[model samples]
Target: MLTLTEKPRRSPKNEQLNSCASSFADYEDCIVGFMDDLQLVHCGHDKKCLGCGEELAHLTLRGVLRGSVGVIGESRLAMTEKVVLLGGRVCAVKRFRQVSSGRREFGKKIEHLARVSQKCEYLVPVAAYLYAKRIKQHGHTALDWNQRLTIIVQIARGIGFIHEQYPPYEKKMQMNVHGNIKVCNVMVNTDFSACLSGYGFTQLAEPVEVLNTGQLMKSPCRQQENTTYSDELSQKSDIYNFGVILLDILAGPKGLEMTKGVKEKKASMKLEGGLEFFEFYVKEGKERRQVSKVLEIALACISTKPDARPSIEEICFNIVEIL
Candidate 1:
C-alpha cells in the first residue's frame, strides 16, 4: 500500500513557521517542506520535483493509495478535492458531502469505480477515497479543438463500456449509467486524455419513475415537467448532457453561450432549424460541413424525446467515425 514519509524538519532560522495557517496553507507548506528535504527545485510555481527543471505534472501513484496523510493538492467538488502523496507519487482525492446514512454504500461504490478505472483509460484514475468536514477548491479549464475531440471520444468509449457492462475479465457486470456527463466532470490527465468523474453522485438525488418504454414520464401537476424529466439522471439524460459538451467543444466559451440562447429559442419556436447555428461561427465551406455533421449528431443526442436518442454504443460509433 502507498505510504508517506515523515514530515521534513523546518529550518531553525525561519521564524515564519510559528504563524497560524489554514488547512490549504498547511498542505502547501508540507509539499514545500518535502521538496526542500529531498533537495528538489521547482519546475515552476505549480510543480516541484527532484533533478533540475524536470516536469512532475505527469506523475501517477504506483500502489494502493491511503487516505489523508500526505496531501499535496486540494480542490472543491460536490464536497472537496485533494491531491495526496502515495509511494512517492501524486494522486487526486475526491471527498463527498456528509450525509446521515449510506456512508458504507458510498465507499463501496467508489472502491468499485477505482477498480474499474484501472482497467479503462477513459475513466478518471481514482487512488483513494476520504471523508472530511471541509476542503479547498482547484481550477481546471477546457481544452482546444484537437484536444477536446480526443477527450470527447475517450469519454464516449468510457460511457459505452459502462452501458455494455464489459469489464476487463470474462465476467459481465450489470449495465451502468453515467448519470452526470458535463464539462466540469471531465478531467484532463497529464497526457491530455479525458477521465470522467462524479459517476455515483447521481444516486444521491431523488429517483424518478421511468415508463415501461424506457422513457421518463412527466409529472401530472407540473407544466415544466417535460423539461425537468429531460434533465433527470438516466442513460438518455447522459447523452443530452454529452451533447451540450459537444456544443461547448465546437463553440468556444463565448460561442457556447450564444448556442445556448439559440437552443432555447429553437425550443420555443418548435422548429428543427438544425445546423444553421454553425453558419454564424463556422466558415461556409468544408470546415462548416464537417461541423454541421457533428452538430447533427449532437442534435440527435439532445432530442426532446428520450426514445429518439441514440444508445451509448451508437453514439461512440458515430463519434469514432467523425474522428
Candidate 2:
C-alpha cells in the first residue's frame, strides 16, 4: 500500500530505485516490498533499493520468506517464492555474516569454488555475492524437526567441486575443511542437490600484532585454537563434520528419541550429571562395528588429535565410492 510520487523523488537506497529504473524505465511503477533495516526497499529483480540512490543491488532481499527456513545461530535460511539470478529458478534465500575478513574475499572463495565445480560431482556450490540483509524480517523461520521429518537434508555439488579441484596432496594433507559444516549451513536446490553454505568459520593461523610487546603472535582461529596443526586447518575436519551431517540426514535419532538425546547431551555438556552419550560410540567389540560406518567416520574426524584423521577428499571419494 505504499505510494510513489509523479516526479520520482531520489530514493534513499539507490539499488532498489536503479533496479526499478532498469526494469520499468518507461512504466514508472512504485514497487511494493518489505524495506530492510536501512529503510531501503529491495525490488529483487535488479536489487535497486528504492530508498537511496545507489547503483548497488546485487545482494538484496525480494520479499517475505516462506517455507521451512529459519535461523540457526547467526545464519538465516528461508524458502521464498523468488528467483536467484544464477539459474533464475525459485530458490531459498540464505543469509549469514560474511567471513571475518570481508565480503570481497569471501565472494572470491565462492567464485574459486564455482570455477572448478565441474571437477566435483557430489557437492553444491554457492552462486552469488554475500551481502547484508536489506529486509529486516521478511518473516523467516528455521526448519522445524517435524517439517524435515524424513531427515533428508540435500547436499549440493559444491563439496564435490572443492574435493575435485584440490590437489591430491592437499586433499591427503588437508583439503581445506568446511570448518563449521552443519545441516543449517547447507542449501538444497530444486533438484535435491546439496551445497555447503557457511565458510565464516574457516580460518588460517595468522600472526597478530601485540601492541604491548611489539611482537607477532600466532593465532589459530578455531574454537579455542583446537586446530589440526600449527595454525593449519585440514579437510579432514570438514570430512568429519560432513559425516555428522550425513548422520543427521540419515538417522538423527528422530522424534521423542531426538529430544531425549538432546536433553541428555545438554545436561552432560553442562556437567549437570547425565549419561555421557558421546562416549557411546567408542565401545569396543562387535557392538562398535554395528554402529554404522557413517557414524564411525564422524567420530574419527572429531577425534582429539588432528593427525589421526582421513582427509575430506578421501572421505568424499570414499562416500561416493563406498556408499
Candidate 3:
C-alpha cells in the first residue's frame, strides 16, 4: 500500500517540466524523475507504480457505475457516478472534471480535506482523491427531531470542526475555509451522522459576479469589495451558510424555497408580520417557543454584519441548550 504524505514543492525547473509534459504518462514520468533524483521515499520500485503514482491512487477506478452529467455550476466540472475498489471494498464515487484551470489548487484542497477528515470524523471521509488533466474522485457514504435537534447539533459540530483548525492540521492554512456550505453539501451517513463535503471547490472555481443569489452566496457583510472582511470565504461566511442550512432543515424542500424568497425581505424587516410566517407553522405553545429559539440562532448566523453572527462554538452551545 502507498503511504500518503504531502508532496514536496516543485522547483521552477520542475514546474516547467510539468507544464511541458503533454500526457498523463509524461506527467507521471516527471514526478518519478523528480522523486528518483531526490531519493524521496516512494513505493519501493525503480519504475514507479503507476497505480499508486499519485498520492490518492489506492482508490483506483474499478468500473464506471454511471455516465457524465456535463459541467455543473461554478466548479465548471462534470460529475459521474463510478465504483472504486479501495482496500478490497467497493465504494461509490463522485468524479469531477475541471474545465480549464485551477486543477493544482483543487488537488491541494482535496489533500487538505483528506488530512482534516482523518482527524475529524464529521467531515466526509475521502476514500481517494486525484488530479490530472481533469480531476477524478472516489469515496463513500442521515435525520429527525429530538431528531431535529440531533441533526442541527451534528451539523454544527461538523462546521465547528472545520472552523477550529487544531494542531497538525493547522500547518496547511488552506484547510480553514469551507467556502461552500449548503444542504446539498451536507451528507448524512446511513448511521444518521452529518458530514460536510463540498469545501474549497467554490473558491477554486470561476467566481460568480452577481451578488446575493444561489444556495451559496457572498455573506452580506463582505458584499462591499474594500472592507477588511471582504473575503467571501471565511469562518463567519461558513456560519452564515450554516444558518441557511438550519433554515432549510426547519422548512421542508418547498418551504426552503419560500424562505429564500423571504430572506431579503426578512433582513429588511419588510416581511408583513416578521417571522410570524415561520412561527405560524408550529403550534402556539412550547413547540413554537422552541422553534423560535432555533430560528433566532439561524437569523443570527445569516446576519448582514459578520461581527454580529455567533461563532460556531456559540451556535453549538445554543443548539445543545435548546435540545
Candidate 4:
C-alpha cells in the first residue's frame, strides 16, 4: 500500500496512476456524452479522472468510429456524424489521419486521457473507440417550453462539468476550454435529451479583430494589432458562442442578426424580468420566470470582457436552481 498523506497529483509520464475506470458505455439510452480530450486528471477534482482500463479500440474496430468527438491541433483525425451498429445501437465515430503512435502507445494514451472525466452524467459515455482511424447539437429550440428548457439545462450542466475540470495538459497555459459549443454540434439522443459534442477542438480560423454582436470578441484592454489563435480559445469565447446559440434558440436565426449593440448588463436585467426582446411564449408568470433565468445565463456567457463571464460551474448552478 502507498503511504503518502498528501493528495495524488498528476503522475509523471513514466508512472501510470491507478486505474479506476470500468467501461465507457452508458447503455440506458441513445444520448451520447460530452466530447473532450483523452487526458488524465487527478481524481480529487469534482469529476474524477477516467481510469486506465479497457479504452483501446484497435484497427480491428475500424469503421466503428465513423465519427469522432473532436480533434486537437495536428492530431487531426478524420470524422463523420454517426453510425448504427448491428444491434440498432447508433454510435459516433472519428478516424485519425496522421496519428503516428503505435498500437500499445495509443491505447495507453486513451486510457490515461479520460480517467478524470468519466463521472458526469451529462457527458455521454463512449462505449468503445477504434484508433485504427484517427479522430468528433444544437437545434433543440423547437419543442415545448418544458422540453426546450430541459435541453438547455442539460447542455449547461455538460459544459459546466467540462469547465470545472482542469484544462488539458497542452491547454493549461494556452487556456483553451470547450472552445466550440454551437447548436449544430449539440446532439439529441433517443430520449430527446441533449449533450454537448465537438468539445476541445480548437478552431484554426484567422484571428478576428471584430466579431458580430452575436459573437462578441473578448474585450481587449491592450491596444494590440490582433488577437492570436490562443487568445480566442478561452472559456469566455466559449461563453460567447453559447450565448449566440441560446439566442438562436429563443429568437431563431434572423433575430440575432439585429443584436448589433445591445448593452450586456442592462439588457440582462430586462431579460430576466421579461422576455420582451425574444417574443417567447410561456403559460404563466412562474414558467416565464424560469425560462427567463436562462436568458440571464446567455447574457452572462456572452459578456464582452473575458473576466466578466461567469464560470461554467456558476452557470450550471444557476440552471439547476431554475429547475
Candidate 5:
C-alpha cells in the first residue's frame, strides 16, 4: 500500500548495478570492443535466418535470433538479437528493435540504455549492433526438470537490482517502466544468472511491429490508447508485468491452470482440495501465499488510479522484506 509522490530512478554507478569490473572505463571503448569481437555477418532477413550470410565465429553472451517467436500487444513482435554489458560484470543479451533511423541517433539511445542498464538493473541496455542467428525449437524438458536454485536466486537478484537504483542516473531519468514483461523475455544464462530483456514494447522512435507469429498471442501489458490513463506506460505497469512473470515462475507450467481456475471457478484444481493444493503443489511453502500477494501488487500497479500504484522503490522494499 505504500506509495511515492515521485518515481525513484536507478543509480548508474552503484556497485550492485555496475558489477562489471572490466578495465574498460569509457563507455565507447566497452561498446566498440564488444561489437568488434562479435564480428557479425548478415544473413537475409527471414523469419529464421537459416543461411548465415556472413556468420560470426563465436556467439557473444547476447545476439539476435534470426527469426525469434515473440508476441507483443496485438502484433507478433519481430526482434533482432543484441548483446549488452550488464552491471559491467556480466553480459546479457536479447532480441530488440532499433529505435532510430540514423546510426547517430541509434548510437545515442543504445549508449543511454546501456548506461541506464548499468545504473538500473531493471531496464536492459540497447546494443551497438545486432547479430541474427537461426533458432531451432527445442522439445519440452522432462517434468522432473524443476527450477534451478541458482536461477531462482538470480531472478531474485535481478528483480532486486531493479528495486534499488543508483545515483546520477537516478537523478536524471524517472523510474523506467518495462512496459512489456513476461517469462519468454527473461533469460537465464548457463550459469543460472537471470537478466531482464526485451525493451521494444517501451518508448521506440521508429515503427512498432511485433514478431510475426502468424497467429495472435496474448500480451499481458497491452493498453488502449487515448485513455484516461495516458501514463499507462509508466514504471508501475512494468511492475504489473513483472508480477505475471513471478507467477509464471512460482506456478511453473501448470501454474497457468491456477490462473484459469481463478477465472473459470469450474476449472479442475491441481489438487483435490485447496489445502492439498497449498500443501503439496506449491513448492515455495509460505512463498506460495506471497504469489497472491504479488498478484494483488500487480493489480494495484494496473489500477485505473495511477496514483494508487506503488513506486518501484516501494515495491522493491516490500518484496525484499517479504522474501
Candidate 6:
C-alpha cells in the first residue's frame, strides 16, 4: 500500500492541501467554489474568544440512554439541546461519557484542534463546544434530489481535503486523517449543504452528539442505527468509512446487513443488486445512471485491498462528475 509519500493527482496546489475558503461557515460553499481554488489559505479565528481559552472541569456523568447513546471509553452519553444566547442558533450539547484526561488537558486539546482546523472548509471548524453534562433530551430533503447530491459532494470534498493535508498538520494536531466518518458526524445545514465533524480528536473528543436540522431527516447521511467509533485509523480506513456511509445512503434499513454481506463475501457489489434498494430515489434513467456510478464508487471505496481503495481526491472528482 502506498504510504504518506504518495502525491495527489489533484494538483500542485493540493500538494499543500489548499482550497478556497475564508472561513469555516462558508466551507460548504467553498467546496462548490473550488478544486480550482486549491491553495492553503489560513482561516482567521477570534483572538480573544473564550472558547479559544478553554478551562476543563470533570463531570461524573451517569447518562440516561433514552435520548442519547455512545461509548466514551468509560461512561454512557446523553443528549441536550443548547441555544447560543448571542446568535439564537440552536446547537446540540450532548454530555460525554468517562473522560480519562484532566479538565485542563481536554480544554487545551479543543482549543488546539480548533485553531489548526481552520485551513479548510470541509473539515468543520469547531463552533465552541461546551462540556455540559446533558441533564435533558435532544433534537431535509431536498427539492429534493439536488440537496442529496450537494450533501454527499460536500462530504467527499471534506474528506478529500483531509487526505490532502500536509504532514506538518498531522504532526501539529496529532491527527490529520478523519478517524471517524460516520453518518452522524456529517452535519447538514439549513441550506442543505453538509460539513464533516468529529475530526482530529480520535483520542480526546467523543462525538456524543449529533447536530440536527431539517435536512438531516431525509438526508442520505442520517445517523446509523448501530454506530461504532475507533482510534486506530488511517486514510484507507476513512475510505471504508465513507463507503459504508454511501451504502447507508443507498440501502437505508438494509445498509448494515448489506455492508456485512459485502465484507464477509455474502453479497455481490454489483449495480443490479444495489439498484433494487435505492429504486425510489431514481426518477429518471439518467438519475439511475448517476446512482449506479455512485454505487460503483462506494464499492471501490470499500475495497478490501488498501492499494485498491481510491483516494478521497479521486472520489471527489468522480462524485463531482456524477453531479
Best by lDDT: 6
Give model 3's TM-score versus the native structure. Answer: 0.55
**Clashes per prediction?**
3, 33, 3, 37, 19, 4
Candidates' TM-scores?
0.55, 0.40, 0.55, 0.55, 0.48, 0.59
lDDT of 1 at 238: 81
Tens-place lDDT per residue, model 3, 216-248, is 222221221222122377888888877776665
How much lDDT does each candidate structure score?
0.47, 0.35, 0.48, 0.46, 0.37, 0.51
Q: Give candidate 2 misplaced runs (Cα > 4 Å).
A: 1-73, 76-99, 102-110, 117-121, 128-160, 164-175, 189-192, 199-232, 253-291, 313-323
For model 2, how big is the CA root-mean-square deviation? 14.6
> Model 4, range 187-301, lDDT digits (tens) per residue?
5654657766445433212222332221111111111112111236677777777776666666655435535433444456354544445545655676777766776677676
Local error of candidate 6 at residue 145 (angstroms): 3.0
Model 3 Cα displacement at 318 (Å)? 1.0
lDDT (Cα, tens digit) per residue for candidate 5, span 1-323: 00001112236576332321121122222245453434332222221222222233443323222112222322223332122223221222232333333544444444454545555443343431212211101112311123332333344455556445443233223334454455555555433345565443344333355433322323322221111222245555655555444434444434433654443442233222332222124344554544445544544554456577677666655555545
On TM-score, the leading prediction is 6
List model 1 lDDT by residue over 245-271, tens digit each.
666566533334465565566543223
Give the lowest summed-lDDT range of ten residues in model 6: 58-67
- What C-alpha lDDT does candidate 5 achieve relative to the native structure? 0.37
Better of 4 and 5 by TM-score: 4
**lDDT-based ranking, best first?**
6, 3, 1, 4, 5, 2
Model 3 regions more than 4 Å off: 1-80, 84-89, 99-109, 128-144, 166-173, 203-231, 253-287
Where does model 6 exceed 4 Å of error?
Answer: 1-44, 47-94, 128-143, 168-173, 205-231, 259-275
